[model samples]
Target: MTDHGPQPVERQLPTEEARDLLALVRDLVQREIEPGAAEEEEAGRFPREVFRLLSASGLLALPYTEEFGGGDQPYEVYLQVLEELAAARLTVGLGVSVHTLACHALAGYGTKEQQAEHLPAMLGGGLLGAYCLSEPSSGSDAASLRTRATRDGDTWTIEGTKAWITHGGIADFYTVMARTGGEGAHGITAFLVPGDAPGLSAAPPERKMGMKGSPTAQLHFDGVQVPDARRIGDEGQGFAIALSALDSGRLGIAACAIGVAQAALDEAIAFTAGRRQFGRPIADFQGLRFMLADMATQIEAGRALYLAAARLRDAGLPFSKQAAMAKLFCTDAAMRVTVDAVQLLGGYGYTADFPAERYMREAKVLQIVEGTNQIQRMVIARHLAGAESR
Candidate 1:
């Protein structure tokens, strides 16, 4: 089957360096990512080497400070890079996002000593990280998480299960939130635990519907010990830190959704142009052309929305509402556009012979991850209406 990758997106970058960075990313994606994405995804193989290459190339460290082995790129540039990676394969793109999410607490709240000690290796030392907040019972209601962290002198022991962890079994480190005090949001504390910590084990990876190349699993912390030095921020600040990270992470999801939509639209366009109809090419039909137009428009709109939210974040402004809106609109748009791509391809789209089917399957998960679209709507509503009355 012919693979139609997305066309180069004309990006408006802030500097010549940013343009060069995007060019480098596009070249890397074409050479290292897009070519084998279908085969690897089909085989349920995780591309750890690709992530290592990204780390060595400094791609994984963008949006972080250069003092700590980071690229110091703005969020706008970082998000565009994510779009390019996600256009080729979502596993890689979303993996980078999760790694960034894992680093947020330390980068934003950890002390100077902690940052100097850990940020360098985490940002660019070819190490992967995972964020642990959601548990088996609490996902959308993250504040209700039941994982416990019992402190004794200089050490803390964690005991609980974290579900739907993106890099559960394979990560080099994990940023975990566990209950440390009372009930509710203020009770949680964040800890940076090494993956090899005793009593820390991961169950088998979850059999997911899509993004098979990425492993999602349940992580069990059975008396996993972390030193006091590994704690991030004051006790009872984990929930707030997680929420802050999520605002940025949602924008990453939004960018990735646009990438998937763009890929699906490209596939639909390529298929329609070549596949002949009763009298002429299917691309000549008015109905299909309109569908293609809508797909392109939605991709463009979604991209714009995510970039707008990213810019707000870069400016050090409040962007939680905008991030929620972007995640909601972009994922919904991706779902609609990918379904339309499959419809435009007809039976071939339903079969594994074409990538339209895979895109559709993958698109379904975007709306569900990084907080469900339903949850995103609630966030946006809360921003507009102010907090719901108890």
Candidate 2:
């Protein structure tokens, strides 16, 4: 495949170091990721080797502290790098996001001894991780999750199932939330369960509309035992930790959404500029030009929205409301822009020969993952109107 993806986006970096980091990311995406993205995704192949490369290059752990082998980049720079990766391929971009989410609980809340023991290996040791919260009976109302983790002498025994887990079967570790108290959100606790724990198993990956290369599956924990040392934060703190991670994770989704939309727009522009219709290039049509303009505008707005939220996070300011807004706007914009890209291509957009259709498909999951756009609206509303009555 030729290099026909979107050009590198213009970015405002906080430092010279950030600029160099973005340059390195663009080079990697061009040479390693973009070339085989469509073909590998079509074959349902996960790019484990590419992930290894990312791990080695320190791209996988950019936003964490450097004391534990992370790159120590701020969230602002980290999210832009994510946008660049996502533009090349959603699987790669989203995979990195999920991995970062998987690390959040322990990174944010783990005891100092725990961090010293486990954080370094996790950040750069090439060990993949998964976050487990939603169960078969619970998704949007995640606090109602039924997964149970019972304590015994020095160990916790985990039971029940986690649904829609990214990196389900292949992850080296899982950050799991299970009921350990009474009921609702406050009852949950988080644990770092080894993927190879006895009785831990995964079902076959979900057959999805897009992102076939990224596995999503259900994980079953039947009497899986974990040492108390692996527990992250205090008992009954898992829900809080999970929510904190989502605040950041939602921004990651927003960045990915813009990336996919940017890619689709690039493809649409390239096609219209070359293909002739009614004895002239279709790009010359006024109607088509307006559509292209709208698509570009939406992509830019989404980028700005996500970056604004990321900057708030970097400054250690309250950003939950803005995070929800960014997630809501950016993902919805992605869906609209990708759809328009498909329409601009007419029949070819529906076909597999062009990437617009694939972009459309990939854009859909962004609206659903992290939290659905509907859920984001509720979060923003809560921030504005206060919590709703039961």
Candidate 3:
């Protein structure tokens, strides 16, 4: 099958600059990301250089203030860029999202001095970051995280393991949430720890079914000392900080899901148009035509859903409920659309020669990451009906 890259998506960008930004992203994806994505992913090679290029181009900082080297674009624009990148290669797109999440604490709650000291490099410099919240015992029940931080004069010693950390071993810094008081959520506190700190180490990356190009591993913070200055937000506020960051991160995952779905639909369209059966192109078959129609419709709907949530966030409204709904819908849509794409390709879809199978494998993880679809349902329900009983 011919690799057509991602088809140009018709988007209603808010400004000429945003339009130009999308064009640039498309150009970059076509030239740099799409060609080697399959081979590199098969080899499990992380595209650190692509990330560095994105940092230099200011794509990594699009939603932050320009005062600290960010692009200052709205979430709506940044998400479209993420969609384009994800359509080309999911690892790069998701990595960008996680990096943005790692920076959220400092950008949103750090004092001016903290912002001045760290925001510039994190936003546009060639530094990578990881978010450490989930633990082996915690996962969706993040309020029960066991990582602990003990105070000692001007230093706080962190001791615990953080599981499922994206960019785990390779990040330049880590935004760590450690418990500083009693059990449950309020005990947690956020801290910024350098990657090469004395006792910080990472276990080997997990062998995953997809997105192998992105490493997911456990991070060990063994009495890793961080200065009091590195603490983010008020004490006992880490859980709140983490949840706020996740509200936005879920939207990133939603955009990525749509990107994957669009890629699959485009591939299916091309395959059905070119593949002939029963002495004619299969595109003439009404059944396959209807399938294609359904795939296209789902992709469009998922795109619209995510964009609506992003606009709500951009408008400074409470978007937590909308974000959860978008993540749940878009990821489920991606799973269905990818599965259909595979079925449409018939035997070819199951083979490594075609990308349908890979897309399917990658789509499974989207439903699980950021938050599980089950967790998303709970979040949405909580917003609608009120929090669940203890």
What C-alpha lDDT values do all the predictions have? 0.93, 0.93, 0.94
Model 3 spans > 4 angstroms off: 387-390
Q: Weakest 10 consecutive residues, lDDT, candidate 2?
A: 1-10
**Candidates sorted by lDDT, descending order?**
3, 1, 2
Instruction: Tell me the tens digit of each residue's lDDT in model 1 across 1-390.
Output: 655678999899999999999999999999999998989999999999999999999988899999999999999999999989988999999999999999999999999999999999999999999999999999999999999999999999999999999999999999999999999999999999999999999999999889999999999999999999999999999999999999999999998889888989989989999999898989999999999999999988998999999999999999999999999999999999999999999999999888888888998998988799999998888889876631
Model 3 lDDT tens row, 1-390 = 756555788999999999999989988898899999988988999999999999999999999999999999999999999999988899999999999999999999999999999999999889999999999999999999999999999999999999999999999999999999999899999999998999999999999999999999999988899999999998899999999999999999999999999999989988988899999999899999999999899889988999999999999999999999999999999999999999999999999898888899999999999899999999888888865532
Which is the winner by lDDT between candidate 1 and candidate 2?
1
Q: Candidate 2 — which residues are off by over 4 angstroms? A: 1-3, 387-390
Give each prediction's root-mean-square deviation over alpha carbons.
Answer: 1.0, 1.2, 1.0
Q: Pairs clashing in candidate 1?
A: none
- Pairing residues by index, what is the TM-score of model 1? 0.99
